[model samples]
Target: MTVLVFLDPAFADGRIVDAGKPALMATDQGATRGDGIFESMLAVDGKPRKIHRHLDRLASSAQSLELTIPEPEVWQRAIATALAAFADDGGGGAAGGGGGGAAGGAEAVVKLVVTRGVEGSSAPTAWVQVSLPPEAGRLQRENGIDVLLLDRGYDSTVAERAPWLLLGAKTLSYAVNMAALRHAHSNGADDVIFTSSDGRVLEGPTSSVLLAHAEGEGGTRVRRLITPALDSGILPGTSQSALFGAAKAAGWELGYGPLVPEDLFDADAVWLISSIRLLAPVNHIDGREIGTSDVRAALTAELNELIAAT
Candidate 1:
């Protein structure tokens, strides 16, 4: 059961719409030209996770596209309405207010979307969609995934040199990203890690790239988490930032990188992290295994605990 709530001025608490009916205008820019921004967040039980971060990123993306959207409070109310509707429709199983990992609770995907409204209207069409998450993401989070390194066809410094490229924004123009994923699937790979034309690691099609390093043993053990530099034309990951904070509090060292494929190959473990998928361990990259299975499992379990706490 999917729920849709439109942010309308006439309705203070947002207007719930029929998800099965045609709700959007055919001329809407989001569908016609893919001119919009969106944020996908996880909703465990009946509450959204990392909501403020998602809203902040949505605002940044709107600003980047010069698209004016509803304020955060408006979006919040609509989100509430949507979640309540989803619950009423039996989509939100039991009310477990704990973290996302809580058993016997619904784990849904909440998507916030804003599109430049009909051609010349100057108003933006916005809505909140609540639905069940894909089972494949949960499976990959547990069983891990095989990835391929694909060139993103741009240099690492492109975002800095060309601000118009909107590399940091999470816009609806995801044709290239989807195409890359399809290519990976065709090649018998489960996912993709994008590399810049200059051979620098960027990110995944829909996630962030993270690599880990561990050394020594027992009391002398040191564990470090590293991700590609934000300036390297990749979307800022809310989950990665949240996990970094939690990991740091747990004594894990953290670093940013201008990383390369060789760095990934040399790391103790690699993962693709995102809000919906959480952390998906990368078992192999370009057909080469990343670290040993035992190390990957240990690190994955450790980090999953930190995520659960969040």
Candidate 2:
């Protein structure tokens, strides 16, 4: 089941709409031209986690597109309305939305989207969507995943050179990202990690790339975490940011990168982190296994605990 709440001024708490029915305008630029911004977040026990961070990123994305979105209060009200409606409407009953069922925690995907609205309109069309997360994501978290490296056809320096590319925004223009994932599936891989044309590891199509390194063991052990630089034309991942904070407090070192594919291969462990999927460990990159079974298991367990603590 899905719950949708439109951000309408006429309704102080926003307006709930039938998700099974048509709601968006056919002429909306967000649909026709992909002129929109969106953010996905996780909700547990009926409360959205890292909400302010998601909202902050949403604001950043809207500003990049020159879009005017409602204030944070409006979004918060709408999300609240959607969650309440979801519970009352029997949408996710006991197992999907708020801390029950098989995915371990009561979890849901809360997505905020704002389109450029109808062609002649000056106002944006904004809404909040809440629904169950896909099971494949949970499976990947437990079992890990195999990945293929794909070229994104851009150099590492493109972000500063081309602002119009909207490299740092979480926009609705996802055709290429989807296509890359499909290409990976067709090639018999579970996912993809994109590299820059100049050979820098960028990110995954729908997630951020993360790698971990552990030196020594037991009493002398030191753990380190690394991800690509923010200037590498990738959307800043909320999950990565939260996990880094949690990891740092747990005494793990943190680093940024203009990382190369070799960095991924040499790391003690690798993962693709995102909002909905959380963290997924990478078992293989281009058919060569990464890390050892024991190391991967230990690191995955440690990081997952950190993420949960966040």
Best by lDDT: 1
> In model 2, where do residues sit more than 4 Å from their true spots?
91-94, 98-104
Q: Report residue 98 deviation for candidate 1 (angstroms).
A: 15
**TM agreement with the true structure for every prediction:** 0.97, 0.97
Write down the worst ten-residue block by lDDT for model 1: 95-104
What does candidate 2's lDDT look like per residue over 1-310, in tens digits? 8999999999999999999999999999999999999999988767888999999999999999999999999999999999888767664455545444222457888999999999999999999999988878888887889999999999999999999999999999999999999999999899999999999999999999999999998889999999999899999999999999999999999999989999999999999999888889999999999998789988988888888888
The per-residue C-alpha lDDT of model 1 at residue 208 equals 96
In model 1, which residue pairs have backbone atoms overlapping below 3 Å? none
Backbone collision tally, model 1: 0
Model 1, 1-310: lDDT tens digits are 7899999999988999999999999999999999999999998888899999999999999999998899999999999999999888877774322223422256888999999998879999999999888778878988999999999999999999998899999999999999999999999999999999999999999999999999999999999999999999999999999999999999999999999899999999999999888899999999999999999999999998898777
